[model samples]
Each structure stands twice: as structure tokens, then as C-alpha cells.
Target: MGDPTPTNPQDETSTQPGASPAGWWGKLRDRANQLRSARRLSRWFNVDDDKVAEILAEVRQQLPTTEALLVGKPQAGKSSIVRGLTGVSADIVGQGFRPHTQHTQRYAYPSEDLPLLIFTDTVGLGDLAQATDAIITELVDDLSSSSSKGRILILTVKINDFATDSLRQIAVRLRQQFPTVPCLLAVTCSHEVYPPSQAN
Candidate 1:
């Protein structure tokens, strides 16, 4: 399409009539206008419109490759869960009481194509009362590249401290931040810490 011919050139002052020729600020303003015009021209078969199509593609590329995030406070037994799921021994697995894993670590599911599943061991986001932004960012990135067949975010705690303020607060925050991310609450050390309810 041809450029938008104004009825009055002098009237193009205020984005209306009597508008001055674009000054510094106006030039910046007109720059966006020029971009829009260029885009319109592209739509009319002038330039390539492929860039607009790449946004979703890029976001998809940025999604997580793994299916789940195993998050909890330090020493909450997330490693134990990982050991159980992967059949890996704790002797080789990194274990700690606060922030056991400093970063997000991906574990491959034992029996499935495309890795069947991915479990991300996030640092003690809920346990250490730390910011989970980096952990969540890693999760989203992984999801972008891989098919998240299923996501399991486990919030773990010791049986002796199941209802601690930190655990409850973290659970609330996780629920609010990721309303759709599937989650499970686990009370670890049950055998040692808390016997059957009837035992008490």
C-alpha cells in the first residue's frame, strides 16, 4: 500500500492538524509510526512477516525439557525421593540439610522413550526460604525444549516438622505461583520421626 497521505501536511502537527515536523521526541514517536507503516507494508506483500511467526516458536523453544521439579527445603529428603525414583544410592547422591542442590539438576527417568520423564532437583526453595526464580526459570526453559508428559513438583518435609511455618508458607507460595503445576506433599523420615498415629 502507498503511504498515508495526510489531507494537510501542516496539520500533521499533533498526530492531528498543525503538528510540527517531528523533533527529537516526535522523531522517536514517528519512529514507531514508521515501524507500523513498514509492518503494514510487509502485510501487503512488501517485506517478510516471518519474524512475527517466530515468537511462539521461540517461547516453545524456551520451555522446559523435563517433566517435573522436585523442590523442597534443605534436608527435606528430596534426594531420597530422587534415589527411590532413579534407584540411585544416597552415597553417590549429594545430600544436605540446607540447599542440598545449589542449582537445578535433571535426572532421567529409567524406563521411557524421550527420557520418559525428567526430574529437576531444585535448591531448597521452600526449605531455605530462598527465591525460586532461577529454579523456576530453569524448569520453564526445560519445558520449552522437551515434551512435558507429566510434571511432578514435590514439596517435602520431615515427619517431625510436617507443619512448620516455612513448609506451609512455601506450599502456599507454590500454589499461588504455579496453580497448574502438579504437586505432592511428602512427610519424610516417617519411620524414625513419627510412628503410626495409633502409636502416639
Candidate 2:
């Protein structure tokens, strides 16, 4: 009988431990695809619908997502905060926000497909023409009530706009519903409160 030989650890032909040759090749192909993916959607990297969906599916599997719910009236600096957080131009922020819920619009930082942070802004809040209850209910439903790390609330109120009865009600109800999710108060439009003599 011929003597048995040991597999060489440094052999270039060796497959990974417990992995078949086909499986090892598949893993290599997947890694190559991920490496080729554009970090952001831009002139340098334009992602098609299929590519975006694929990237998003992979990202959801790999990352721990955190949702930031921005509850505020119209023009209450929600977009401003998103701009600051994302460092995207106003044009991109304006275009990026898409319908999340009936009364909420969401923007994912970096790129929608590869987002680490997500911001959901209430669109119909404080508008006389729209019913705020539906919005509140929708926001409540959107809460990731299980994990405190999964979500947080951002309540924005214009500094000079004291008609906060609605905003206050929303904040109180959301806090009660999801006591675990911490709420942050952002008083916007402070420039209106400050005199011209005051430095920024």
C-alpha cells in the first residue's frame, strides 16, 4: 500500500477548513462584490436598484441599526439637524428624505443602502390642515420598543413659537409609550430669540 501524505498548510490550492472548493470560491466572489461596492452613491459610484437592494440586505445583516425619530412641526429644523449629522448639502437632504410612514419622512445617512444612522421626521406635525393624532400613532408604531439602543426621540421646538400644546402632547405620549427610548429636546430658531448684538 502507498503511504498517506499530509496536506500542506501553505498550499495555494487548499480550501478553508470544512469548506468545499465551490463554497470557498463563492465566499471569495461575495467578498469581491462587497469590496467593489461604492461607499456612497455619487458621481464616483452610481448604484442601480438591484445593487442598492443587495447592499442594503447585507448591511442589515451586519450592522446594528439605530433609528432617530424627529418629531417636530413643519420647518422646525429637522432637516437642518439631518444636514448637520450627514454633512450632505441641502439639495441632497431635500431629495433624500422619502416617505417612511403616513406622516413621516426618513433619511438614511451616508447612503440609503449602507446607512448606519436613520432619521425619521414627522411631516404633518403642527400643520393646521393635518390631523396630528394619526401622525402620533404612526410614530408610536415605528418605535423599536424592545431595545433602548435601537431608537431615540428628537423633539424640536422653535424657540419663539410658544404654541407647544401639540408638541408637548406628542412628546408626553411617546415618552409614556416607550419609556426606554430617551428623548432629546432641541430648541430651534434661537436666532430669532437672540438680538443682533449677540454673537452667534
Among all windows of ten consecutive residues in candidate 1, which has the lowest summed lDDT?
92-101
Q: Please give the TM-score that candidate 1 achieves against the real structure.
A: 0.46
> Candidate 1: where are CA atoms >4 Å away?
1-66, 92-102, 111-114, 126-129, 132-147, 194-200
Candidate 2 residue lDDT tens string, 97-174: 999877889888777766778899898788898787888888887884444337879999999888988899999988
* Residue 128, model 2, lDDT: 90
Estimate the TM-score for candidate 2.
0.68
Candidate 2, 13: how far from true, in Å?
A: 44
**Clashing residue pairs found in predicted model 2:** none
Write model 1 residue lDDT over 37-145, tens digit each, in one string.
9999887885455875576467545644446576666777877887886676776455322232455665555433235446667664553555556555555564455
For candidate 2, the 10 contiguous residues with the lowest summed lDDT are 38-47
Candidate 2 residue spans exceeding 4 A from truth: 1-56, 144-149
Q: Report lDDT per candidate.
A: 0.62, 0.82
Candidates in order: C-alpha RMSD to true structure: 20.5, 15.8
